[model samples]
Target: MNTVPVNFDFSVSSVEVARRLIGVTVLVNGVGGRIVETEAYDREDPASHSFAGPTSRNITMFGACGHAYVYRSYGIHWCLNFVCREEGHGAGVLIRALEPNTGIELMQKRRGMETLRLLCAGPGRLCQALGVTREHDGMRLNTAPFELLLPDQPVAEADIVAGARIGISKAVDIPWRFGLAGSRFLSRPFGRSHK
Candidate 1:
């Protein structure tokens, strides 16, 4: 796999940067996988967490780039987001799913099932499978235990699909959700355009 540049440019729009994440490898511990789905959220976007401004829970979102903005969703499952949009920019690219690459046994064990389709198929499930939680909050992606490595070649643009963001009540019309076209690992509603 080709690794992305050490100095990942984060000064661009989240939409453009989000596309760079496709086909990248996300390694946590001995487990690893290729990112297949993601959602871009900008601080100025009403549908984003930082739109309301940073607080204790979202402070990491306002920190340096490439850090993790992990948080619990619905007070139950942890979801992982990579901080983007330049330094001190409150935005992120939500990792919605992964295509299991390494440590399949570990992933299956953590998920309590053998079905590949169901494992790491959603944001919460992927985090659970990779042991990502609040403990990894603010962790830099350039280090071990948690890293995002770009491939030698990225997914072709023709193979990617963009649509409205899901699981949000606001900014419902924003076409910030992106994923590998027709990938089975994508979360539901990914194909649904903003209505």
Candidate 2:
């Protein structure tokens, strides 16, 4: 069993949290699925919203750990992230993709499409499908409207892959992006060498 500690401790580094989240099932008001892809970011990373310090938009990231940091990408679709590390540490894991297994019909209705793979393949699409928006920012992940459950089946280490993050101009080569190996639900394919 892959047990490198799966307590969802947000006090750890963002990288560790991102890797551990791979097989975890997440539900937002009873609509979500197993997290398949994620990207880690900290206050020191230039690509992170917290790199320059806390702002009104990124203030949630600086708050307590294990909370939602919802934001809009390109002024359009909302993206969801899980804040990590200590309070005022400004670190989080971007929830990039999911293998949706719950509330499939509702997700299809909200996304306006019937394709299962495309429903939660990307951060923006995942948020839209789960009805996550700015309203969820700063909300605790352990409370109502959110449920993060440990995997029933332990995930194997060899099944996880790492690569560079996508849609960013800075810190492009950090290789902080993590995903479940061989999962077709990923937002984008990882390079062969990433494994």
- Per-residue lDDT tens digits for candidate 2, residues 103-137, read 99999999999999999999999999999999999
Model 2 quality (TM-score): 0.95
lDDT of 1 at 76: 91
User: How far does residue 29 in candidate 1 sit from its true spot (Å)?
Assistant: 0.7
lDDT score at residue 136, model 1, on the 0-100 scale: 94
Estimated TM-score per prediction? 0.92, 0.95
Candidate 1 regions off by >4 Å?
1-4, 192-195
Give me the candidate number with maximum TM-score. Answer: 2
lDDT of 1 by residue, 49-142 (tens): 8998889999998998777889999999999988887676798989998889789999999999999877898899999999998999998777
Off by over 4 Å in 2: 1-6
Top candidate by lDDT: 2
Question: What C-alpha lDDT do the candidate models reach, one value each?
Answer: 0.83, 0.92
Q: Backbone clashes per model, in order?
A: 1, 0
lDDT of 1: 0.83
Worst 10 residues of 2 by lDDT: 1-10
